[model samples]
Target: MRRLDPRPCVVAVAVLAAIAALTGCAPDAQPGPGPAASETVASPTDAATPSSPTPTPSPTEPALDPDGSAEDNLPLFTEVVEKVWKTDDRVKGRAYIDALVRAGFDKASMEVTKDRSSVGIPADSIQFSVRWTDACLVGQVGPSTKKPAAVVLPHLPTGGCLVGETRPIDW
Candidate 1:
């Protein structure tokens, strides 16, 4: 038989007493019985199973052709550019204009010029000139007199996505 040390026994009892005291002092430490067991109820053997299946919607009718004019689709281009601009300035600006021009606006016939000037002791100014596509309508944005600091001619709105009058402003 091995004999236990008194000091070890004393330490063990002290630690246990401390633990018990702590557990007792805890706010919600009562060791109560858990919730009662759930009651078992009888179920119908031949109950019809519930079903939920969404009906597929009928396909939407296709839009009619607007006389094959690019001008008719101007609103679409404006909406696309607006949405693109919300998240991407670079994409909404020069990149969008380039895409429109490349996609057939290169032959725009109307010539529009924009001139910007900052009035102050030390002056700052710029100018730009652009051409409108014959296939659609006017398409230009920039300085009017000399070369502009930058120019971007994004697609304009016609009468589909949104209705608004767009005008160039000098600032």
Candidate 2:
């Protein structure tokens, strides 16, 4: 019998497993009810299970976790970012800061970039952030970005998320 290489076979199996995982055919997949699934009465414990975060806000608002990881609060953070992006002040850094404050994120924990450049031209984008524990929830929006985006990122070694100068969240 001819000797065969095992590495190629291992790589092929890994690729297949990844494809299955992404396509939801993996053995450990645990998806929630589909759009057409019928709703039924459930025990109190099962009533509001959040298996995965929804892109849109739920009928009942999600609250910020004061001590939880930044990733856990990203859905709410993204909701606020998206909400602000739909408004007339989408490019205004202050609008993002105010909305985040109203949404219950700490004003002291936030930082935002200027809406305009030193020469007074409108900036291509604005970045805002809220520090949560050891992580930061960062958001960017404006003409350059084309769409609002939010994500959980690790804090910089020197501290804070935005570089250069950031304006105060003072009202």
Candidate 3:
């Protein structure tokens, strides 16, 4: 009778044990959920009851303006401006104005600085604003500016969107 080789058997066992340990299949490891049972499950009587359908607002319904005051809408305006501004570094003046317009700001009441200067040099900063009844919601973004900044300040009694300097939107 040929003698059985125990060396090969020991090496094979060691390899399998190492694989199991590496794969987290140790004997004490907890098992996860298996396939669902073949039996049909039953729900409680209360759970099976049908409830009245809730009415959902239509998509065409206009969204409620944030209190209709620029001060009250400062936070919302800031959030929207930040989201739009971060989308691209090369965003132009019209992009910010358009985004604010889409966010329910009146286009006729909005103003934006040109992306370039009178000499056609790219502006270091750009400003956009919405002229509200008593105040203005202004947002400025650019290399010279910190993160997207927004503010609600009293409208210039002189009749302008912002009090600070802003380039003309010639572009």
Candidate 4:
């Protein structure tokens, strides 16, 4: 495969570790002026209104490395995936795949499961991945998944990351 330019951004090799830290862990730098905190509370007796912390103007995140191994990119990868999980489109595989593309990952290196099963039923969950050299940057999400998950796993013996057949990223 042709090498994509390495961009600084952001993995978990352990599946469980991926979902453990999903919320409010987005890149410290966000576009425009937006609330940095997801929620705020104030003491009823306090005279001052609650204020959210100002987000850093620059990315406090590790840069994503296209030329690096999955482990080297997990931090920014987790952050990007988590950011997508916090959105309304959290359950859609396309959202995560698209977000990764926008974050500088090569779309050609990615794979994702179908949104629905062959029998026309919505899948319990979906898995997506990017083959990064010897490791795979993988992620899962859906109603059944309960939360977005990610990991870096060694390529399967069959030379792919996921075990089952995956959908095409034709779009």
* Backbone clash count for every predicted candidate, in the order shown: 8, 0, 0, 12
Off by over 4 Å in 1: 1-67, 90-93, 101-171
Q: What is the lDDT of candidate 2?
A: 0.88
lDDT of 2 by residue, 66-157 (tens): 77789988888999999999999999999999998888899999999999988999998899999998799999998899799999888988
Q: How high a TM-score does candidate 3 get?
A: 0.56
RMSD (CA, Å), each prediction: 19.1, 14.7, 13.6, 24.0
- The collision pairs in model 2 are none
Question: lDDT of each structure?
Answer: 0.39, 0.88, 0.74, 0.83
> Best candidate per lDDT, number?
2
lDDT of 3 by residue, 19-128 (tens): 98888954545676654798555569656765776687675433427566777777667877887877874347787776777777777777777777778888778888
Candidate 3 lDDT for residue 132: 86
lDDT of 4 by residue, 1-171 (tens): 998654432232454456656644666665576555985645585536336655659857677886788999988778888999999888788999899998888899999998888999888898999888879999988889777788999998988788898989989
Q: Using TM-score, rank the candidates from best to worst.
A: 2, 4, 3, 1
Task: Estimate TM-scores for all models.
Answer: 0.26, 0.64, 0.56, 0.63
Best-first order by lDDT: 2, 4, 3, 1
Candidate 2: which stretches are off by over 4 Å? Answer: 1-60
lDDT, candidate 1, at 28: 59
Candidate 3 wrongly placed segments (more than 4 Å): 1-67, 163-171
